[model samples]
Target: MHMHVALCAVLDPSEMPGGYRFEAIENLVLSRLDRLPPFTRRLVMDPLGLDHPHWIEDPEFDPIHHIRRVSCPAPGGSHELGRLVGRITSRPLPRDRPLWELWVVEGLAEGRFAIVAKVHHSAVDGMMGAGLMVNLFGMTREPAPEAPPPREEEHPVPPEPRPSDIEMLKSAARKRLAQPRKLVDLAKRTVERVGGVVERRRDPELAHGGTPLTAPRTRLNRPIGPQRDVGFARLSLAELKAIKAAVEGAKLNDVLLAVVGGALRRYLAHHDDLPEVPLVATCPIATGAGRGNNNVAAMFVPIATHLAEPEARLEAIQAATRGAKEEHAVLGKGELLQDWADLAPTTTFSVASSLYSRLKLSKHHRPVHNLIVSNVPGPPMPVYLAGAELEAAYPMGPILDGAALNVTVMSYRGQVDFGFMVARDVVPDVWRLADAVAPAFRELRDAVLGAPSEASPERSTPAE
Candidate 1:
């Protein structure tokens, strides 16, 4: 049950070649360097299969046979990287090769390196994704000491490739001509859906989170093109926590929400386009609970930033967030049968997404709710690669239609790493947005916790 999880980042391309030589924590990770393709061209996804198990290993019977690097040449640079990632992510995994790829990018103005990683979401999640980096990177700057054998065994050979790409295209055409059952299946699915939503109106839980299907339109949730913009920001855990402590009932996450609210407000205000009303930040809800798979729901809470006072804004946000949580809690307590009954119509991913992007979109979206923000907590303790201390860690999430920017925070060690990703064309000035995050955090700190002044730290990376 591996979900095809893929995410991208842009870096100082100049440092890529030298960085490439500075090996990953393990020796088994491969580098997939190649020229990038245009947006229209399709990427080749190596088929992952049962024999493959989506795991890789060296000759020895050790696990940790992951970490491949994919590099596309210069001239294409950052923009090209976007198209390459889009080409990679838009397609499903092929069932043969390992289920992940780390595109180590090169060719930039500064000595920086960007890495695009794709892993089956099933194999890794937001929490696990950050841990893997720390586990794989050494925190120490010193030369490597003697190492031991890997913790796992070698991976088995992959299964045989299915019908070749050409053959598959031909097969698809044949099915188009002869498959009426495809249409029938869809029709039956639609009628069954109609019956379910009608009955859900009476269910207590489904009735809790009002209009769970309707999401507001935001600049971030737009129909993104091939272009993308990536930026970074960070805050100390102490500072963020202080803000939470000041608020009467604020959770650490509420601090995160307030900071994001401030950042987005600043970003839109810079353009003289700040929404007079509050913006709705849609946070993901775990649909499967303990059961895994891509099962996820969302809670979109209104964040108040229109008021110039940052404290008031945080207080208002905290209240709104509490309400959202209450609603989700009620939804979670419903009986299993009620869940199925209430969720059947919502089970289809496209129904609500389409409504938000197209007709009948929410008022929050019409003016565009600032941006979508999510904070996923990670291990606070330092992790080692064979024994190298892990450094900075960043987390990213997918951008949906109508929303042009998505701000995701992953807390590692004592720092919270923030990533600001925008659709290139929609938010060409993403770096400014990243810059805004720090000041916003400070504003929350001063008003809420009365903290002192300090410089915002730079993102740390493992040294070669």
Candidate 2:
């Protein structure tokens, strides 16, 4: 299955007389593509699924195929952009080619445009994705040239040949024969890990935290359809930092969790579907260092949605996240999830995945978590692309079978951009939830920085 992750960044008009033309943008993207890391040009798996998949260069690679131009409908505002993004993301990337694409969107108001870049999760994680953005863009509008002069007789390198099905089957049989020893080793590690987790949970300080399979069901936790809805909101990073500094032991992430918790509470209440227990969010933490992809771990964070007061909710979230971090630490920093994933037979996994999706098993079982909330740190310095300033960047994550909502925040130069991805069938009114994010943050801000005076206009208005 193709699990595509995408991010759209709105950019100021390029420093050209008539704004950027399709040909100029396309040429710029092609020039940068030549310098992209080798991994970005490869795809996973082979024609037959008899062996483990690995990345290989595409012999028939074409920059034009992956990069193109599109225009929004009339009135060309954020709503039009969101609808276009939703439509672009609904379809899966073609498996016959490289699993990434970039679209140069036009026809927006204020002489602005947007770039939507989509890459498969199997290729890059949050950290790698951020690094890719930095590499593609520049710190200044007029960046110095770094590439060497092109040769007139350059030839495309041929990709390595794939293994035959017979050879793959033979190798699989040998691996299966050796599973007895692998299973014994896996069992020992599993026991040790489970023991450590159990011991950590025994601490009275951490015992109250939510665990796997304990998340409360909400409208967001349901089987999702192929259709998606995208919404966006922006927050002042400066204000968030100020609020974090004011609150004791509060970090930016903690504040974000609390704000999202508040928004979810209001949204569910509006639909008369608020759960009695606090909602849980699966937070994906990047474990990779520089340039590595797919290196991430997760922790279940209690959003404290049940708490009515903003301060109370923030405090509860701080405590819950603290415990969750402690538990994750006890579990060790090893890639335990990836280690186990290596044991799954590819054929079996493919079959199981197909059946699970076809049967709609997500609706029958209790959700593991209500939703996914992730925060990816971006460059604090200004970033420019093709001589255009990056005004804001909002990342959209893939929705799973049970978890139908994904909220991702990317902190850019001086602002935080939020992207809400929801299943269209489950929550078509996702814009309402996105709109609530700013007000929720304002509530937390008021609680931290005493209520504003009645005469002040800022007290009544929420930050945009």
Candidate 3:
């Protein structure tokens, strides 16, 4: 999967010092590079393809290589900016360099600009990606104080020369030699989890997280092309929290998923393609231990898109999330998934993925899930980069081959920013789904808290 994650931030340059200048912004970001690790590291794959890739400091690391400048076309609006972002994300990061880039895009309307930070998924996951953005754009207008020294575990040793091929092979072999013990442990855990599943199935009160390949085939489950389309949506964090408080047993995430389900229902019904059964979403659950690593597990959740009423959908989503979490815990959270990955040969996965795509195997089988929905927490207060105020920040996650759409949400300041990334050919009118999010939220809010005295001011990037 040539997947990368990104955050597209639209800046209000009114507060910027001397307005927007590409060189000024570039220098500012370079000055703060010490705070980021992945900015200077390049991937080094195992020669025998027996192990996961290792990251090492690039001897020829240059800030200018990763930092770039671009100009938005005329009538610079959200749609124009999104188009720019789509083009940026379509390309893969070169392995010869550190897998990241920060584009300082100028020429936005009202003298606004944007920063699109793209990083390879191999270097960072949702948590680390969000952290990198925050660090890049400090909390205030001034340059941040010298970042404290990284803990020993964060960067145990100073940068060293690249390991020789023989050295890498020996390290890979050592890990392979220990795999039998890992396999035995994995088998034991698998048996225990199987028993747990059986026991849970016997309990009437227990709910299931749903299984893979059970999702109904829809227009969304198709092979994706190289091109991408993006859309933006915004929700008030306070309003979401209010609804969470009003509804019994409802968490913020449940409310968020309910909004997505309602939006999907509207979008699909508009297309006359609404499925009779509820749609399943592959929700990425964080494992909490690996702060800077891709420590995540998948939980398939029934989004209750078939439910007509907003409150009913919210209630169903709350219960579904609970069930998913329970099942996830039963599966040892992410440990089981990580163990299996560690035991498998890395090349086997690469070959299988290549074959799957080459043969168009997705059409021959039920889709694994409908789409990927990820929730990432962002800074609570206003953040600035080089003296520019961040108006809106949309976090984008990579879409898969079968599931060609990804909806990633981030709560920044008081607004929850939704980034809808879809394969251009699969969901060309992604703007419709993006535009539906607010109305969906309003319907849910009214259903739970009753009508408000006045309409809440809608805040969103004006994407076409």
Q: Pick the candidate with the highest TM-score.
A: 3
Candidate 2 stretches with Cα past 4 Å from truth are: 14-18, 38-40, 44-50, 143-158, 163-177, 207-209, 289-292, 452-464
lDDT of 2 at 164: 58
Candidate 2 TM-score to native: 0.91
- TM-score quality measure for candidate 3: 0.94
**At residue 34, what lDDT does model 3 achieve?**
71
In model 1, the Cα lDDT at residue 56 comes to 26
**Whole-model alpha-carbon lDDT for candidate 3:** 0.84
For model 1, where is the 10-residue window of minimal lDDT?
Answer: 31-40
Compared with the true structure, all predictions reach lDDT values of 0.53, 0.77, 0.84
Question: Candidate 3 lDDT, tens digit per residue, 1-464?
Answer: 55899989988778777766676677666666678888878878778887777779777776657888899888888888888898898887888988999998888888888989999887889988888888788777773234333333223236668988888889999999998898898899899996997789688887777678999888999988889888899988988998999988889999999999999999999999999999999999888756336777789999999999999999888888898898888888878888788778778888998888778789889999999999999999998988888888999999988988899999988889999999998998988999999899989989999974254587667322
Off by over 4 Å in 3: 143-158, 453-455, 462-464
TM-score of each: 0.63, 0.91, 0.94
> 1-464, model 2: which lDDT tens digit per residue?
33788999888765742456666556556566545554235645534564556566666666656886899776677777888888888888876677888888888777788899988887778777898898788887763234322432111344566555666677767777887888788878878987988887776756334687788888898778899888888887787887789899998999999999989988999999989899989898865533235788888899999988999999999898888887776665545666666677666677987888788887887788999999999989878776777888889888887888999999987788888988888888988898888788888888888863233232111111
Question: How many clashing pairs does model 2 include?
Answer: 0
